[model samples]
Structure formats: structure tokens, C-alpha cells
Target chain A: MEVNHISKSFGSKHVLSDINLTFEDNKIYGLLGRNGAGKSTLLSIMTNRNFADNGEVKIDSEDVSDNDSKLGLMYLMSEVNLYADGWKLTQIMKDSESLYGGFDHQLADHLIQEFGLDVNQKFGKLSTGYNSIFKLILALCLPVRFVLLDEPVLGLDANHRELFYSELIQSYSDNPRTFIISTHLIEEVANIISDVIVLDQGRVILNQPVEDVLAKTHSVVGPQKDVEQYTKGLNVIGHDMMGTIRANYVYGDLDDRILPDTVQLSNFDLQKLFIFLTNQYEGSGKNENK
Target chain B: MEVNHISKSFGSKHVLSDINLTFEDNKIYGLLGRNGAGKSTLLSIMTNRNFADNGEVKIDSEDVSDNDSKLGLMYLMSEVNLYADGWKLTQIMKDSESLYGGFDHQLADHLIQEFGLDVNQKFGKLSTGYNSIFKLILALCLPVRFVLLDEPVLGLDANHRELFYSELIQSYSDNPRTFIISTHLIEEVANIISDVIVLDQGRVILNQPVEDVLAKTHSVVGPQKDVEQYTKGLNVIGHDMMGTIRANYVYGDLDDRILPDTVQLSNFDLQKLFIFLTNQYEGSGKNENK
Candidate 1:
């Protein structure tokens, strides 16, 4: 699937600006962005739930707008609950099965038992965590080629979140497909996602494989002057200083310059990288509208 | 502050049962629990926002219920917005200052600048993340001795969450107080909290200093048979197996047992400990009310 020059605006605010992205087959992608970075809007446009002001979303070179067949190939489990409040979980699943087709009843039943969800209970009666669990169950059981999960583990506890990750991996292994997950819990999904797509102020800032992103990023720590000297010409996204010690977060390759005795280079995690990258962009004040 | 034999129920549902806990001054506590664990209910009861079916909450040997002076020392920043929808952030802060007294305007203004929050925006107009930031600013600037935060970073992004944690630590350092944070994001708060309290099925399952709990938990890994033999007669909370390899999570002291050549012991993190401990209690089928 491809998002080509997708731009959207609400009134005077530009939510997405000429956004372009490509999602390959049989891969897990982490869609990362700040609170108002237009992730949900982009997802909505891609799924035809919302229309974009410019460009189009295409699957296999065919535009997905108002295209039922292409739309059926993708499923988006977002935080919003669209089902009727009075509907029971089982009834909702049945409705989804008929509408989407190819629902895995066996997997759904297993998940219901595993999560201890009572299918007879009304949708509105479930707690926040259970509501998230129910949506996750549906997303996993559907036989869609692309599964987009937005805040999939919104209110899940540690045990349930672990279970969901394991189940997702198991399902993916059994039937490989594209899974694009957008969540605030970066550390938890860092290792789970194969590739990452980061959006900053409605623009695609970083899109690369997890391994490549981590390989290029480094944390240079030591005396403030020495660390700054080592990262002088590099892509230092941000830095932190505590008294005389400093740590420069670099997002690009390091030079062959001999390392100073006082400076040490170490790999940083995805969460830290995200924080620094986003923070640096915020400091630039490129998009003051948001 | 102490919670003595507190119990609460709503109609046919029992929310909290015989809960007992002590919050020491100048310390941070992580209150962890699964969905429907009655964590919110317990916090409400402790803060005198809700009534308990039995027992009482006391501070310095004085009943906190109906005692305005004692209750004034505590503040509960919950998910629900208590301010009027049309009220602006500045007005809300002013109201809090009048009601709570000793509101630190300097810290509040600094936080507003740091978080990039627009104080002129109405409470209802703020985005989810901004709303959380507003509540967090209030919680931090308040002069309460016991501040209870329920899902403080609910909608915050990676950068904002990191900032909140750092700001929280800084605020605590500047003004020594008790902060009992109840959140599902366990790993994030694991290091920030000095003590952890786990509630399961409306019952207090585990409560201990973070260091002490982590000191006793071990992850025994090896061949399935070897791992089982090594962990025999020990408090093995949970275990995972893949083919021939097995890992058993134990939560108690080792009895100086002979070590098998194929087995190795290592430390487990707070999240792992919480998962294993909660899962063990669930398997026992105690209470089963929730």
C-alpha cells in the first residue's frame, strides 16, 4: 500500500501535509508520532474512513477510495468504539464476521477464553481494558492482509499486554501479513516491530528498518566539551547535561575521528531516540499551528 | 497515612476487600493492578472521595472521613476532569489555589512553559495530551503532602511522558511529599517509585519496597527438567518453556540447593515480577468476585 502526497486540513489547521509512505507485504511496522502528529488522520484517510484533501491511497496501483474490495483487505482497530452500546460481544463478532468475511471463529473463541471475556456481556458494560482486549481479539481473528492497530494495549495490564504480543507474533508466524501498530508505548513495541515510520508535524521524518535506525543512532556521553567536540558535525538531534557531564544523542553515523578518553559511545533505545528526535523538531517550531 | 481493613462494594459487586496499606512521607509508591482490581476505588476511599463499606482511613491517628483539615493535606488527580468545561487553564489554577491554598504559582508557570501548554485555552478545548498535562501541572504545583495520581500520563506521548517523570522527580526533590501513582504502564514507573503495591481481584496481593521485591525475585533458566529440579520446593510463581529450554520465575529465597550444570539463575524485573505474582493468584481462584 502507498500513501502518495496525502494532505489533509481541518478548517485552518493542516493536520497532514504532503505525507508519503509505502507499506510492504508480510512485515510489522510501527507507526510512531507525537500526540497531534496526524497519525490517526492519516490512518483514517488510508482506510477511506476520512477523505484527504490531496493525493490518494493505493493498493496494487488501484485507488482505495470508495473501493470496497481494497478496503476489505485492510482492517483498522482504533480506540473509538463504533458498535452499538447494547450489542453483546458475540453478536458484534458475528456482525463483523459477516461484514468482513473469513473471521477465524476458532481463534476468537480461544482468545475469549484466554482473556476471560464474557461474550454475553454488552459492549458498553466492559471495562476500559476489556474493551481494548475485545478490539484486539477482533483484529487478530480477522483475515485481512493489513491490520492497523492504534493504541492496541490502551488499558491492558502487564500480563494481558504480554499475552497480546505473544498471540500477535504467533498469529503472524502462522499466517504472515502486514501489521502496522501505532501506540505511545514505544519501548514495548520497539523490539516487536520490524520497521518504523515516524511522523513529525505532519511530515514523514524517519522511515527505516529498526536495525538500521538503531545502528546509526548513538549516545555519546562524557565531559560536556568532549562530547560536543566528538558530535560536532554529526546529526546530534538533542542533548542532556547534568552539571559538567553531557550526553549527545546522535541519529547519524559517527566519524572515524579518534574517540577522546573522556567520551564513551553507546547505543540508545527506540524510546530515547523518539523523544530526542521529536523534541528537537519541537524546538525548531516548524509547525506552530498545532 | 494508613488504610485499615477498608472494604467497599457496589450493589452486588465487591470493589475493595480488607485493604490495608501505609504510605510513608516523602516517598513515591507505584500502585499496580489489572482491570477491575479496585485500585481507583481504594484511592477514592483513601482520599475521602468515596465511602467504604467497612473500616476507615486515618492520618496521624485521626479519621480522615469528614475531617476537612486532614483531607486538606491530600489531593487526588484522577482521569475525570472536575473543573467546569468553559473554565480556562488559568482560572482553574486560580480556583485550585484558593481551594487548596499555598499553590506554587512559580512552579506552575514554569511547568506551563516547559509543557508548552496554552493557559488561555478552555478546559474542554484542550487535546487529550494537553488535558493530561494540565492535570499533571496541578498535581505537581499543589502543596499537598499526599498526592494520589491515577493514570497521570494517560494520553501523553513518549517525550511528554519522559518530561513528566523528570518533572515529578524534580518536584519531589524540591518539596518532599508522598506520591502514590496508580498506572498500568508498570515498566515506566518501576524506577520512579520507591515502593510497589499490587491489587488483584479487589485484594492486596503484594506490597513491598521496590528494592526488596526485586532482590528476592529470580529467573531460573535451563533445560526443562533441570530448571524444575532447581526450583523445586521454592516459590516458583510462573514459568515459560520453549522446546527444551525453560525459565521459572521465583519470588522467594533460594535454599542453598545444589546448582545443576544446565541451570542458571538471574534477576527478573518489576514488570515480570508483577505479571508472575498476579497470574499465580488468578490461578488460585481466590475471591473470584471481579
Candidate 2:
């Protein structure tokens, strides 16, 4: 799947600006961004739910606009509940199965039982967590090659989130496919995703494998002077200060020979790196949220 | 503040069952539970937003029900937005200041700038994350002695959530008040909250200081036979088997002198303990979500 120079705007406010991305099969991708950072807008444009003002989204070199075959290949579970409020859980499942075709009824039944979701319950009556669970079940049971989940575990509790993640892993292992998860909960999905795509102010700021990203960035902490001296020539992305102590996030390898006993080096988690980078972008005040 | 044998029900479903707990000032408490586990119900009842079927809620030996003076000391920031849609962010703050009588406008302004919240925007126009931020700013700036935050970080991104937690610690340290946070994201709040309160099926299953709770529980992992033998006489809370290996969670101190070299002991995180305990209670089916 490819998003080719996509650009979108709400009146004069640009939501996505010249965004370009490529998603490969059988890989889990983490689409991370702050609130109103164009993560959802990009996903919606790719799925054809919303149109982009410029450029296009294509699958297998074929435009997805008004293309039934291309549309059938991907499924996007968004935050909005498209199912009717009066519909029963079973009814929704049945309708989705018929529309999507090849829906895994067995897996759906198993998940329903595992989550203790009653098929007889109406959609509107479900709690916030249960509502999210129902939508996730639909997304997982579908036999689409590309599955895009937006805040899949939005209202799930700790145990339920754990169960969902384990279930996702099991599903991926059994049948490999492309999974793009966009969420605010970073640490929970950090280890599971293979690739990281970070968007900041409608532009793709970072797109790399998780390992490669983590390998290049590290936090070096020590006395302020020592830390600054050590990271002077490195690509220092960000830094934190606490009195005489300092921690600098360097986006390059360190020379072992120059290492001192007073300093310590550790890799930055995806969440920390994300926070540091976006903080810089947000502070610039050029790309404000409309 | 104390809840004296509080009980609540929704028609035939018992939402809260004999919940009796106490809250002291100058402490941070984590009110954790599964979805539909009665955490919100307890908070609502304590804040006088919802009436209990039985018993009374008292603050300093004074009944809080319909008592304006006592209720004035407490504030509940719930998931549901209670402010008028037409009101602007600045308007709500001013209204809250008049009602609370000692609102810290300086801190409110500082946080608004830190979060980059637009005070001119109407309440209904804010995003999910911004809505939470607005309410959180109010909760922090208020001079109320007891602050009850229900899902305070519901829609916040990673950076925003981190910022909120740090700001909360700063406010708590400066003012020294009681903060009871009800949330499903356990790991995020584990380090900040001093006490843990686990609600299961409308019951207070566990309520203890974090240090005491963690000290009593540990995970022992090793060969299946070795783990089983080691935990035979101990209070085994939970266990997991993986082929020839096993992991057992014991809720009592171990005699390190008698432990075999193959056996490894590790501490259980608050999330893991909460999951294990709640899983057991939920599987019993006696406290089902209605």
C-alpha cells in the first residue's frame, strides 16, 4: 500500500501536507503522533473514508477510489461506531461476515467467549471498553490483508488490553498480514510493532524499523559538563537538565574509547524519543492545532 | 473521609456491594479495577453525584450527603463533560473559581500555556485529549482537599500524559492533599500513587500501601517440579505453565536460605497483581457486568 504525496485541508487549515508512506505486507506498523497531528486524517484518506485535496492512495499500483476489489483488501476500524445503536452484537457480526466474506466465525466466537461479550446485547448499551472490544473483534475476524486499527484498545482495562495484545500476536502468527495500529498508548504497542512511522504537524518525520531507530538514539546521563562534552560532536536530538545532572539524547553511536566511568549510556524507549521530538516541533509554534 | 458500609444497585444488578473505605489527606491513592468493576460507582458515590442504596459517606465524622460545606472540600473530575458546550475554556475556569472560592488562577494559566490549550475555544470544540486536559487543569488548580479523578488521562497522548503526571506530583507536593485516581492504565500510575485499592465485583478486594503489597507478593519461576515444590506450602495466588517450566505467584515471604539455585524470584508489578486478582474474581462469574 502506498500514500503518494497526499495533502488534505479543512478549509484553509492543512491537516496533511505532502505526506508519503509505503506499507508492506506481514508487518506490524505503529502510526504514532500527538492529538491532531494528522495520524487519523492520513489513515482516513488511505482508506477512502475521506478524500485528499492532492495526490492519491494506491494498492498494487491501482487507485483505490471507487474500486471495490482494492477496497475489499483493507479494513479500517475507526473510533467512530458505524454500526447501528439498536443492532445486537450477533446481528452486527452476521452483517459484517456477509459483507466482508471469509470472516473467521470460529475466531470471532472464541474471542466473544474470551471477552465475555454477550451476543444478545445491543450496541448502544455496551460500556466504553466493551464497545471497543466489539469493534476489535470485527476487525480481527475479517480476512482482509490490511487491517488498520485506530485506538483499538481505547477504553480497555489492563487485563483486557493484555488479553487483546496476546490475541493479536496469536492471530498474526497464525496468519501473517499487514497491521497498522495508531494509538496514544505507546509503550504497550512498542515491542509488538516492527516499524515506526511518526507524524508531526501533517508531515512524516520518522519512518524506520523499530530496532534501527532505537539503535541510533540513546540517552547519556552524567554531570552536566561531562555529558555535554561527551555528546558535543554527536547528533544530540534533545536534552534534559536537573541542577548539575544532565541527560542528552544522542541520535548516533558512541565511541567506546571515549567513555568515562562518571557517565552512563542507555537506549531511549519509543515513548521517550517521541516525546522529545514532538516537544521540539510543538514548541516551534508554526504547526499549531486548529 | 470514610464510606460506611456503602451499597448500590441498578435495578436487579448490584453495582457496588458493601464498599467501606477511608481516605486520609496528603496521600495519593490508585483506585484500580477492571471494566465495569465498580471503580466509577464508588467515586461517584463518594462525591455525592450518585446515591448509595445503603450506608453513609462521611467526611471528618460529618455526613456529606446534601451537605454543601463538606462537599465543597471534594471535587470529582469525571469522564463525562459536565460543563456547558457553549462555554469557553477561560469561562469555565472563571466559573469554577467562583464556585471553589480558592482556585489558583496562576497555576491554571501556567498549565494552559504548558499544554498550549486555547482558552478562547468553546468546550464542545476541544478534542478528546484537550477535553481531558481542561478538566485536569481545573482539578489541579482547585484548592479542594480531596480530588477524585476518574480516567483523568483518558485521551492524552504519551507526552501529555507524562506532563500531567509530573504536574500532578508537583501539585500534590506543594498542597499536600488527598488524590484518588480511578484508572485502567495501571503501569503508568504505579510509581506515583502511594496506595493501591483494587475493586472487584463491587467489593474492595485489596487496599494497602504499595510498598507493603509488593513486599508480600513475588513471582517464582523455574522448572515445573521445582516451582511447584517451592510454592507447595506458601500462599500461591496464581500460576502459569509453559512446557517444562512454570511460574507461580506467591503472596508470602520466601525463605531464601532453602530456595534452589534453579528457582528465580522476581517482583510482581501492580498491573500484574491487579490482572491476576481481577481475573480470578471475574472468572467466578458471581460479579458479572450487567
- Judged by DockQ cut-offs, is candidate 2 incorrect, acceptable, medium or high? medium
| Residue A173 of model 2, lDDT score | 90
- The 10 consecutive residues of candidate 1 chain A with the worst lDDT sum are A281-290
Cα-based lDDT for every prediction: 0.89, 0.88
The positional error of residue A192 in candidate 2, measured at the CA in angstroms, is 0.8
Residues B158-219, model 2: lDDT tens digits? 98898899889888887899999999889999999999999998999999999999998889
User: Where in model 2 is the C-alpha error above 4 Å?
Assistant: A255-257, A281-290, B255-257, B280-290
Going through the candidates in order, state the TM-score of chain A alone for each one.
0.95, 0.94
